[model samples]
Target: MISVYHYMTIAAILFAMGTYGVLTRKNAIVIFMCIELMLNSVNLTFIALSRHLNNMDGQIFVFFVMTVAAAEAAVGLALMISFFRNRESIDVEEIDLLKW
Candidate 1:
């Protein structure tokens, strides 16, 4: 039977993959996606624990996390679009506009 441990394992794997992607990738979009993945993994964990504990708070927290993730994604995409337009590239290493 599937249990909270299974869900937690999946969440852990997803979080690790996201972390690796964030650390190794240079593209702004990929990094953005990795951040989303990490957020999702956390959501999974929250839901799993909520279910295991028969409590509502974790699920409610997941709702808040999702809302924040959505906002973050919208803002991140906007920033990426603006940066791409300005620099003609999305490579993180190539971005120097922020350097004073």
Candidate 2:
């Protein structure tokens, strides 16, 4: 039977993959997606633990996390779009819009 440990393991693996993508990818969108993946993994963990403990706290926290993630995605996409418009590319290495 599947247990909280299984879910936790899967979440950990997904978080690791997301971390790797964030560290190694140069594309702004890919990095953004990786960040989302990491957030999802955390949500999974919260849900799993909440179920295991028969409590509502972790599940409630997941709702807050999701809300923040949605807001972040909107703002992040807007920033990326603006950056792309200004630079004509979303490469992280070329992001110097804030440079003097």
Candidate 3:
């Protein structure tokens, strides 16, 4: 019988992987993907807890979080595209948008 604990554990593993990828990856796109992964893990947690508690609050919060994540992905992708156009590379270490 699967339970909330199982879901929570899976989410925790996913979050950890995302965190590690974000910390170690140098590519902006990869980092963005990792961020998305982390967000998804949080969503999983929220859904699990919402079901466990038989409440709507966690689900409601997940809805808002998804909305924000969508907006962030759009803006982040746009910025990455613009940066790539300017520098011809998306390496995090090479980004110097503020400098001439």
Candidate 4:
């Protein structure tokens, strides 16, 4: 059986990688993927705890979080498409059109 500490370590690593990608990537799609990675890391932690505690609450919460994340992806992608159409670029630096 896998240990809780090991699971936590894996989650931590995934979260850190996601954070780094989000901070360093310039493409909106890549940033979205990083956000999903972070969310999945949290879900992994929740699933691990739920199994360890023999409880359903954590898994249920993860389901809700996944639903929200899906909605967020749809909306965010739509916005990114709109921005790309208007600006002809998806680079984060070129997003300065929003700045006044």
The clash numbers for all candidates, in the given order, read 0, 0, 0, 0
Runs of candidate 4 exceeding 4 Å displacement: 98-100
Worst 10 residues of 3 by lDDT: 91-100
Task: Write down the TM-score for model 2.
Answer: 0.94
True lDDT of residue 32, candidate 3: 95
TM-score of 1: 0.93
Candidate 4: Cα lDDT at 44: 95
> lDDT per residue, candidate 4, 9-71, as tens digits?
999999999999999999989999999999999999999999989999999999999999999
Q: How displaced is residue 15 in candidate 3, in Å?
A: 0.4
Which regions in candidate 1 have their CA more than 4 angstroms from the true location? Answer: 97-100
lDDT agreement with native, every candidate: 0.94, 0.97, 0.97, 0.94
Error of 4 at 22 (Å): 0.5
Angstrom error at residue 8, model 2:
0.4
Q: Candidate 3 has what TM-score? A: 0.93
Q: Give lDDT for model 4.
A: 0.94
lDDT of 2 by residue, 1-97 (tens): 9999999999999999999999999999999999999999999999999999999999999999999999999999999999889889999999765
